[model samples]
Target: MYDWSALPRGARASLSVAGLVMAASFLGFGALVRSLEVGLLPGLATTVFIWALPGQVVALDMLASGANLLAMALAVTLTAVRLLPMVVLVMSKVRLEGARRWPLYALSHFVAVTIWRIAEDGIDEVDRPQRLPWLTGLGLALMSSMLVMTSIGYHLAQSLPPLLAACLVFLTPSFFFISLFANAKFRMDYIAIAAGALIGPLCHQYYPEFDLLAGGLIGCTIAYLIGRAGRKRSK
Candidate 1:
């Protein structure tokens, strides 16, 4: 139902901004790995293979501490497990019945936080058949940009000034926050964001080891409960 020709314009524009932000984010990550003396090749491999920033951070931090292999594996697994809900939500929207399973398997790797937000916001504008291709192109472009930036960050870590490097690292989350606020359509979205902001720092202070997981679970649960109560009261 959709033509590939219509993909270029939107894909190009979206990629321009999103790719740059992703690149900046990974550049900071690469530099962090370099500063930790984690070996350039292994850091690049983590970026390519693990592909999740938070998981990579956890792994690198554990490795630096000379944590046990089992503990590191468990931590990485826990961080990556957060992606499951994201992948499920995304697949529901773009996947077609009777499509080849292999491609879907491949595409699932691209369903990280950034891609999820972009796809969730833009998928409605795309034809059903073309949604996958649009997302595929967007993911590929962002991934490629991050890889290149990671290399730049790793090799040039020394030459890049500390302040500039810090700015690059901050760009990703800043972009994510802006994008989330811009696209928010419901009261629940605001509630979730506010809850996370308030709860996340407290968790980090009290339970640094499990801060991310604890904050997410508690914040999301509270947000859900509040939304449900509001809906019932409205009726």
Candidate 2:
């Protein structure tokens, strides 16, 4: 229904892999939700409309920590801020001269770690004339499987072993790590991720409400300033 016929052979191959990865990670998320007593339908909404796993993780973690609803939502939204630049980048890749623009907008809802990966790999091989439609098909495939896989995960939650549940969650984080790591072609991202990771918990220790956003912003700024100084001194 999303028009896979327009995709190149390579795109389909790449998208299939992406779809599989999405399916696997979602399976994990759903299981975690069930195990943790979070409702599956909310998990589905967060994954569906939000499409930001870091945000979802933060929300789940905050809720488990007894965080207030406002605080939890804020943390989740902060994590989702990463998606803005991603959406921009993906949009830039599309030539956008066709009548399929509505589909592109719709498919944007499905944009996530795995979808982005396949798009990164498949975009070049796809014909320029068909790039948008190809991406639509790819995104749709990934999105379609999530609900189905999540339902499967929900049903299987109690029966699955704890170790197995842990492994399933690895899918989301692993894909996200790969995507974020790819953004670090330059040296600055190293500083950003490292500083943020270090300061993040520290911030939580002090101001629980401001932990994520403040730490990430402060760390990123520090990293940028340090990187800038290094570059200037090198000159």
Give the Cα lDDT of each candidate: 0.74, 0.71
Candidate 2 — which residues are off by over 4 angstroms? 1-15, 63-70, 98-101
Clash-forming residue pairs, model 1: none
Candidate 2 lDDT over 54-150, as tens digits, reads 7876777676668898887777877777677767777777655645567667767766666666667767776665666777666655555677777
Q: Put down candidate 1 lDDT per residue, 1-235, tens digits, no spaces.
A: 3344644554564555555666777887777777777787777777777888878877877777677787678778876886898899888888887776665677788788777877777689878777777777777666677778888887777777888766655654575567568756667778878887889789989976655556767887898899888888888
Clashes of 1: 0
TM-score of 2: 0.81
Each prediction's RMSD over C-alphas, in Å, is 4.2, 3.4
